[model samples]
Structure formats: C-alpha cells, structure tokens
Target: MNNDTVIVTGSKLTIDEVAQVAINGAKVGIAPEAQQKLTESREFVYELVNSNVPVYGFNTGVGANKDRKVEADYYNQFNVNMVRSHCVAVGPEASQAEVRAMIVIRLNTLLLGYTGMSPAIAYMYRDLLNHNITPVVPERGSIGEADIACLSHIALTMIGEGDAYYHGEKMPAKEALAKAGLEPIMLGPKDGLALVSSNALAAGQGALVLYELKKLIQLADMVYSFSLEAFKGNVSPLNEEINRVRRFRGQNESAAHVRKLLQDSYLWIPHIANALQDPLCFRCACHIHGAVRDSLHYLEELMDIQMNSSDDNPCVLINQNAIMSCGNFEVVNWTVAFEMLGIALSHLSRAACFRTIKLSSEHFTGLPRFLTPDPEHIIAFGTIQKPFTALDAEIRHLANPVSMDFYAVAGDIEDHCSNTPYVVQKTRKIVDNLYYILGIEAIHAAQACDLRQEKEFKLGIAGRVVHQKIREVIPFLAEDRNLTVDIANAYQLLKSGVLLHALNS
Candidate 1:
C-alpha cells in the first residue's frame, strides 16, 4: 500500500494487494515467471490460429456461431467487431474507482497466463491503470456469469473505441489514449475473448466492499457498546462464560468486544433496582453481532480466493497440451456469500434501531421520552425516529436474496447468471443505510448518557470515548432546533473512525 509498485504473479493476489494498487494508485507489474508463461501461451495460440483447427474465439466464431469458421485475414476485424457490437450496456456509469478495480482484477487474471493473452495484452491493462485512463463501464446489463457487457466496454477502450475518462475529463477512447501518451491496442487471436470474458467488474467491487466492511463492522460494535452503556443495561448477557460454552467463535468474539468496551463501567457492579433483564435488542447483541462477524470470516475467505482465482473460460492448458473450455465463470458461491453479509447487516441495523427506540422511550429506559431535555416543553428527537425506521426498512428490503433471481441469456449457452453485481450493489446500499442508523443511535445514546451523567452515573471506556467525540462535533440535546445537522455530524464522526480508534488506542 506504500508507494512501491505491486507485482502480479502466478501466485494468488490478496484483497489487500488490490486495494494497494487500486486505492493507493501504486504501479503494478507482471512477475518474470508470469511473463514467461504469458509469452509461451500467446505463441501456442498463434500456432493454432495459423492452423485450420476450429477453437472457440481463437480461430472460429463465438457463441452460436461455433460451427462457422473465421478466415485468418478477418481475425483482426472480427476482434474489433466483437468489442464494438458488445457495447450495448445501458445504465449509470460506475465510479472511476470501480472501473479501475475491474481493470486490475481482469489484468491479474490474464497474468495467470492460461487465457492465451500475450504479455503485451497484459501491459495494455497495466498502462490503463498506471496512466489513469479509466474505461467508462455501465452499472447494469450484466447477468453475471461473466461480465461480458461491462467488460466489452473495457475491451472497446483498449481498441480506442467507446468512451473513457482521462485526467478527470470524459472523452473518446482515441483521445483518452493519446492524452495518456498511449496507443490503441489491436486484439489478436484469443485476446478479444480473454478481455471480454471475465467477472472482474463484480469481483473488483467485492474487493472494495471487503475493505470498507471491515472498518464498518468494528464501528458497529463500538456504537452498540455505547448504546448498552447509555441504557445502563446489564452486562451479564455478554458474560464470557456463557459465550464460551456455546463455542461459536463469532459470538464469543462479539461478547469479548462488548466486555472490553464495558471495562470500568458501573453496569458491572451489583445493583438490585435495575431491570432484571434488558430487551432482546440489548440482550442478544452478542449473538446477532457475532453472526455478522462469523459471516465476514467466511466472506473474506471467499473474496481472497476470488481475488486470486482465474475466473475465465476456454483457458489454454500448456502442460496438458490442450485448450480446454471450463465453467470457472460461475461465481454464484460468492454471490450467495454476499447475500449472507447483506442479511447479517440487516439484522445488525434492526438491532441498532431497536436500541435507539428503546433508549428514547420512558417505558424502556425510564429516560425522558425521545431523549428530549424537557419532555414537558421542548420537542426534540420526536420526528428523528422516522428516518431511523425508514433506514431499517430499506436495509431489510435489500437483504432479500437475489443470488437465484436471473434468467438465461446468450441462447442458453450462457444459461445461468450469478447476479453478483446487483448483489454487491445492494450490499453497499445496506452499508450506507446502517451508517445513518448508527448515527441516530449515537444521537439518542449520547442524550441518554448525558441524562445519566446528571444522576452521577459513570460511562464505560467505550462510552466515554464515543460521547467525547460526539460532543466535540455535536453538543447534547439541550433544546432541539434542528436535529438533522447533529445527525449528519455524528455520521461523519462514525465514518472518520474516531470511535473505533478509542479501543485501538
């Protein structure tokens, strides 16, 4: 992640490495071993292309035209036509960051050297990233078996067709390539197929999500701990003994996090007057949050493998001395894993929302209704709960699984679809909604903590850190003028990692 260049190799690439190159703008190169294999593979494909043999996408037509043969003279135009004709994607443009990540993933798969693409072809991708020329990829039109429609746009960029963003200016690919001091690439033999056939667009977004989700998971834990403290809830529910007996690693980890956050708190001391037990939202925090943590472990494992694997088809096998077609393009397993993440996040968001509602209700926390300073005169946090409820509903709706929700395409040859892009995009939306929910919880929790402070109650270590940080940006709800400003500031604080840093520090 430092400024040093990342080396792509036959060895598996980690999500961390991709983050370094894509997010940090670090240069990327092909390892010597990968380069050697790339050259050999390209030579082998050229030999087959020259012969009268019919290979899918190499010497003959593609898809339903497999029986039809393409003349060697027309191969170049065939490649160009393949890229241009497939540029039918329609929707909002993906962020340049996502487009960059897609190119990086696609280039890494090519360096695996099984797709019969030359080192020259791979360098074209490297230059695209290094020079900051991003192919303008659309957000829709992919059923996700392979990112044909999306990646075909990228293929168009390579050949100086379609649109690209260069130096922050949207322009024609020919202009962008010239602006970057690069030339248009001519795809040869199987290079066009290799470029167009990939799951890079989806996989790229997944890698970024994994990186962002890590920080959010820890932030969710910190905010929930603050909620428990604000409500003066019993800490017995997070007892290590109970979690240890269950033997669920994620549950135990969640319990430990809560226990650590509650260190030096008054909640642990014996008190007879407190409620005998808290509501399910506070009591089952460990189990629900732990499931989320557990799912993340599984997701990270899948993402790491995905980041390293060759998600391609009709890959050349040099050792077997044959070009074999395959089904490595099926990424439904990863799509399902993302759905599990979405579901887990939905549960966590609902719990956070419930805790917020309970904290503001006199019947639940015995605090002033809506956490208002003066329940008799001042109207504060009254209408604030509407947005939290709305956010929770949105999160829940997006959590519905779409991994099994697509029809066949390409005349049934590419029959199945993974819907990975839609899955990832929905998961990203859930993450967005959860942040506002956390902000609302923080707003209510800070008020409850402030009210308890009036009664000589002490906050836990985690509670103190969150309260202090929120106080820095937003004062307590002394009298409500506009709560939206406060909520926005609190959300920014959460995203800024101020709360998480307390535990780490």
Candidate 2:
C-alpha cells in the first residue's frame, strides 16, 4: 500500500483529515491483507459461539449484565438487541460532520479485528462514507463508555433499522439504504459489543476540539498583538533571547509569534523609549499565554494518539487464539490533559479580559477612556455606547472553568468521568469569547492609531495582515453606531482565518 494515501483503518485518521476525505472526495479502502485477519477473527468467534467456549461478549452479558449468559443460538440476536435498547440518546441530532466522524471512529475500532465482525461490517461503513449516508446520532448522553447511546444510534442506522440522513434528506435507515443502493448488515457474534463499547465518540469529539483549539490559539495570539499595540506597552520582554532563557519551547514559540506580529510596528517601536517598561498584562503575556500554548500542543499529541488508537476492551488475539484484558479504554490520558488545558484556557481568557479593561482605563493607559479618539466621548465609552466593551464582557464570562469542579454520579460506575464535555464546551465558548475580545482590542488599537494621527502605524508581516483585515471590517470607528455590528464583524474576520493567514504568510 502506498503510504501517501490516507487509509482510514479506524485508529489512524485525524478528525480534520477525515473531514477532508469526506468533503474533498478522498478514496476509502481496507488495508491490504487486513481482510485475512478479519476472516481469522470471525472464524474463531463463530467457533466459540457454537462450541460452548464461553466468551465475555460473544455469548455472555455485558457490564452489569455479564452474569446472565445467553444460549449460543440466541447470541447473534442478543448482540443486535443490545444495540437497539441502548439507542437512548436524546437532544438535537449531531450534525452530519459529527456523525461522519462517529462512523469513522466506529469503523476504525472494528478494523482492529478484535470485535469479531465480518469484513462486511467495515465495508458497510465504507459504503456509508462512499455514498454519504450519515446516521443522525444525538450529541448528549454517554459518560465516555465509548458513547454507548451515540454508538447505538449509529448501529441502528447501519442495520437499516433506524434513522439516517440520505442525500441531505432525513429518512428511515432502511429507506435511506435503499435510496443509496445499499443493504443493511447483520451483526456477527461480538459485532454489537465491538460497535458500541468504547471511547470512540469521546476521542472523535476531543480530536475535533483539539483541532479547533489549535486555530483558537492562533487567534488568541493575534488578538493579544492588537491589545499590545493599543496599550503601546514595551516589547522588550518579547525579545527571543528572553524566552530562550526560560528554556520552554512553547514560550519561545509564542514570544516569537508575537514578535513576528509586532516587529515593524510604529506604535510598538516609536514609543518604546518613552514607555516605562510594559505592563504585566502586555510584558508578561508570553509567560501566561505561552503556558496555554504549550498545553494545547501537548494536548494535541495526546489526543492524536487517542483518536488513532483502539481503546476497546477484551480485544481478540488471533495468534494467541484468545481474548485478553487491556485497559486501553481507560481515558486518564485525555482527562488529565484536558483538565490542565481547561485551567490554562480559562486563565488566558481572564488575561485577555483584564487586558481589555486596562486598555480602557485612564489609570493604566493614558489613552482616552476605552481608547476612543476623543476624550470628550469618555462618558460614551463608560456606557459602552457605539463601542463593544459590553459585548466583550459577555465573551469573557465564557472563560470561567467549570471542569475544575468534579461531581460523582452513575451509581459511582462513572464517579470519575472526564467531565471533558464541560472542558470542550467551555473551551469552545471561550474561543467565541476570545474572538469578540480580540475584535474589541482591534477596535481599541485602531482608535489608538488614529488618535496618534493615523500615521499608518507600522506592523510586522502577520500583524499587518491582521490589522488590514480589521481595518476592512471596521473603518476607524470615527463616529460609532452599534458595538454589536463591530463585534460581529471582528468575529467573522477571526473565524475566517484572516489573522491566521497573516501569521502563516
């Protein structure tokens, strides 16, 4: 097999890559000779189910249901029934993108050959992706037990027994399969257990979250650059050598990014002689922001391994001709990383919020209150009229850390769930918050530039691009109409990668 092609073997696909394949028309196929392993595993499972060689999931019950053994004749029906009863997830259905990711994850897990499913199951998933018949899974439920409810919803549609999206239309799974010229597949032995019993959903969701976080980190750096310029804080602390001394890679990279963003700035360089060493919010930005930056990078690696791994329990061993206990399903790795990132993300948020506050205060920044061009409009700034100060406050609130507080539930079976849902949700909320805060910072920076006589304030390569984009959406805020529009415009720029494009270029 050529390594250049991205083979979705279930454990090795990234969320972005998978999305790209779906949206960009990448070819999907089983790995060469993987079918032989699939055949060997299925034969073993079948022999066990028929010859009374009892297995944990092949003929016995599951999790609290393990003690009750099923007769060999009913094992296949038992597996199929297990999926139907577990499709209890409720809420708005997950979008097609998320559902496709779910299919990718499920197929990847099955491809490990431990689930005892026939090759047809993997092919059916491939068929769904090939034809774009995504299941409509719910977003809620599942305490990370491989997202039981969500996976069940996926399984139901796969068997032509549930709901799905067909050619952008919601239809019964059977009807959708018929429309797509496909047929429902039957569960073989432990196939149902293989499908619904792991952390694929969490891993997929976490992987997507990490990808967004990477982009959000870039956005955060760009916004901070705007804040630094607006406050006209000293840039000495961002000197590469200062970060080099700390010997932290992320700190060095973040400081370098900031420097690249602000290097040629007339605002940054022209006033350095008069400015009395920068404020902590501006000068110590790397120390604070860099920690978050490094945390996110570290998290990306951990999540990458998780997303590209098989965490299912009781994996089959074709060579050993037996099943073995493996704790791959345990999610401590992600729990710890997400918890740390949550703390870092929240602090970065508070830092941005406080910096915004300092930019508007006459006590800290001699610039007119809120950095407006006219000091006579101080009251207008106080009321946050015609500007986005009030909106920034709402965005800042999203940074509060809800994941730090833990709770026990699920008869203590899930007493220590990752609470990662809160982590990812809050991280997403803060990303939105950071967008607006950065917008406000840009508005303030632009006003500061104009107040200094619109002297074509110089900026570094990346900063110039970000500054130009901000300028496009918001002209100098000369008179101020509605802050909300400015906030929305800034968010669009942030989301659309104008700032990021500048940094990369």
| Candidate closest to the true structure, highest TM-score | 1
Model 1 gets an lDDT of: 0.84
The sequence of per-residue lDDT tens digits that candidate 2 reaches over residues 47-104 is 7678877677777877667667888678669988999988888776766766666666
| CA lDDT, every model vs. true structure | 0.84, 0.70
RMSD of each: 1.9, 3.5
Over 4 Å off in model 1, which ranges?
454-456, 501-505
**The candidate that achieves the highest lDDT relative to the unseen native structure:** 1
**Candidate 1 on 1-505: residue-level lDDT in tens?**
2457888884577787787777777778788888887899888888877777678888877777777788888888988888887777787888888887888888887877788976777889999988888888997888788888888999898889888988678999999999988999877787778888889989898888887788887788788888887888888888788889999988999899888887887777776225889999999988999889899999989877776777767878888877877888889988999999999999999999889889989887778888888978888887988999998999999999988877766677666787898899899888878888998898888888888743547778888888888899899878867878988998788877777776688
Candidate 2 positional error at 373, Å: 3.3
Clash tally for model 1: 0
Among residues 3 or more apart in sequence or in different chains, the pairs in candidate 2 whose N, CA or C atoms overlap within 3 Å are: 10-108, 11-308, 146-198, 146-199, 265-458
TM-score against truth, every candidate: 0.95, 0.89
Q: Name the 10 consecutive residues with the lowest summed lDDT in model 2.
A: 378-387
Error of 2 at 402 (Å): 7.0
